[model samples]
Target: MDAATAWLVAAVSLLAAVVGPFAAGHALLTKREPQVATAWIAVCLIFPAGGALLYYLFGINRVYTRARKLVAEERLPPSLAPHPTSSSHGIGPEYAEQIRISDAVTGRPLEPGNRIQVLSNGEEAYPVMLEAIEGARETVMLSTYIFETNTSGRQFIDALSAAHRRGVDVRVLIDGVGEYYTWPRPSTLLRRAGVPVARFLPPRLIPPQLSINLRNHRKILVVDGQRAFTGGMNLGDSHLLQSQRSHRVADVHFLFDGPLAQQMEAVFAEDWAFTTGDERTPPKRATPHDSGALCRTITDGPNEDLDRLVMTLIGALSAAREEIWLVTPYFLPMRPLITSLEAAALRGVEVKILLPERNNLPFVHWATRHILGELLHWGVHLYYQPPPFAHTKLFVVDRRYAQVGSANMDPRSLRLNFELNAEIYNRPIAEQLALDCELIRARSRQLSSAELGERHPAERLRDALCWLASPYL
Candidate 1:
């Protein structure tokens, strides 16, 4: 072919690549959040190849949707969800009512009276979780987005393996991609040891092309249908050691007893039923503890027909009486969230946000700065958690309610990824969470207009370019 003919052929092929999915993406009848739809359109327009790549990477596929339809077609028995006993503590009336609505919507009650404990980092959470697994009697259910079969992951494997051998009804779930070469097949090892493990939304067995975007991003652990844990902590060596690895992630996890733990178990049951089809009639077990805290679990995913994280933040911020505090590894907020944060500060609601000084994704870190400048101007106090990549995501409101989990304040998470979080409304737990925020504050400094202006022109341009591509990040 001549040079002119070759150029025309190349142009035609590129057009087909963009137009095909762009048309299918809109035409498909799958449920999507309004913000996600808007962002998807923006992503397609800005960079065609990049958008196509993202659409393939995290985009929804028809197979899973069809599988869901097939499952819905079957007549399944009622999976028993007996409520757990409550502890001796309940939150104030205002917070309690929100719990009621969440309970109704989620079909899981907040055990009003429960003892809550905060595990500062992996060093604390790891041992506690292992102990919980060690004590499991009826069931030991665990799910994580990233489960490296590395050295650290192996310890968890050993623990779970021991639990399985002890006649504990053990079930483990890991994301197919998150455990990709960096880790080995945890499920395979468990299978060899006669334990049951399933990959949530595993890659399609038939067609390799369909394995692109589907992932189970939830990180949760519930033991014996009683005690439970959830947060950013994944099973890995980096979470334990300051590591020789490229980027060490700092994360937080929670240990729950009382009604909230039951709520977490319910969340696990849903994923378990979806993955294994082992809808065994589980027992009604809720151990009431002495800690006074009101807690509920909230699960979000592409399957959920709403933006749970963004809505929860906006609702909490709008209803704030005195203060609001937040922390996340990624700081890119969509338009509605940005506006909500700005309005909360403008109304004299003490608003503070903590993000990592050095995020694992540097491109995203740079992109988050431009629009974030607008927040600082609106009196939204911004603090950067110093060193070691703070991966914790937290939200506290009015000294009463707080949420902690794996979801970050970024488009990729708020819109695309599946995540799990717990909303707590007990004074002592709230205070403890607030104290954790302050420790991050002690290490982080406030950003000023002066510092933003002092950036080198080259740095500014780099940030600006990345900001334009924020939808994909």
Candidate 2:
């Protein structure tokens, strides 16, 4: 070999030797999942120069780092409001530990006197939400993952614009990534309509902000600091199954009237402040009476608030005595969660999980199939609700404790996305949610070990591959 070519080869080998191990070591030290770490480590070692660049660009936990910076600068507001009137009465001693778990994780008090109404779909949720916007006397703070520019989304845009024109304190926050679901994005339409709107962490070229993993997946609509709406539903026509012929989704949303609404307002305020750098002054809310239910909101994301909802879920699952009913669109449970489910079922608790028979994301559903045998072996019953794909996310324990909101059972919702969930300590509400699940369960088909085992080898291989990539999904 010539002298110049030999020098080039030596330089390349030296660069690989230095960069590859560094990236692999970083993944080993920082990644939470062993499989994820191993995958990155293998990539770094196998491809050396290119793999290290990939790890530097995509493998690092830049989301958490950026979030930590926001917190350090006091840009991200605290999850809970101040001077909360926590209700300790009427709740049984059985839920004391559960209460403690949430309290410790969120530091948010249980807001009493919350009157929650279940809205079946956009048909029910949208009208009430629009009515609340129309009737807003003070403020209308709305945030959603997707704000499509379809027929249903336009109604919301018009309502928010009308509310703004009427001198109401109106603010709309749409997820940066989800805004691209349609052309003539809602932000643009809202801007043209004289409504104040902001996109959460939108992709930008000037500032070079392009990361899309840590998205704002929260769905919140707080009106007048007295009424709020939140759930798995988004502001889009797909949720209007009554009118749509295909790609329709079935979901549930809840309207909160009482102190819980104020708490939700606080959550929106924090998210808005973080997104737009505008500190919103929350309106003084009247002291609400102890209505029918007690609830607390749990806000989680890829920041310091990470793992809070998952911890709350594990705590609730561990505390389940009689029954546990969980429903979600996605079904990729982490190892600890799967272990908790197994333990719950072994303790004589009836553990039932409901998932969609058809999924909007087929890869997620395929990945979910890979873990069915493990859960089934532990006496956990799993069911698939028939299509029009179910988009509801719910968790109920013993018909006394329940949770509902935008966070799904997958890693994207629990670990990466900014999700909002509420823990309800009302027997009636829990029973109602459980009953809803029961009705769906009746129409659903339960999965058996034999069914999973009978899958073709190639199909199982595909599912296994998808499962291995669940962290990214």
Best by TM-score: 2
Error of 1 at 110 (Å): 2.2
Tell me the TM-score of model 2: 0.92
Cα displacement (angstroms), candidate 1, residue 344, comes to 0.8
lDDT of 1 by residue, 70-170 (tens): 23223222223323322223334666445534543444456665666677666788889988988888788898887777877788889999999989988
Model 2: weakest 10-residue lDDT segment is 75-84
| Candidate 2 accuracy as lDDT | 0.87
The candidate maximizing lDDT is 2
Report the lDDT tens digits of candidate 2 across residue range 1-473: 99999999999999999999999998998898888999999999999899998787567777657674444234223333222344346567877778877777777777888888999989999999999999999889999999888888989999999999989989999999899998888999999988889998898778877667778999999888888889999998999879846889899999988888887888888778878788777556635665668888988887654588988999999989899999999999888999999999999999999999999999999999999999999999999999999999999999999999999998888887889998899999999999999999999999999999999999999999999889889
Total backbone collisions, model 1 = 3
Clashing pairs in 2: 113-291
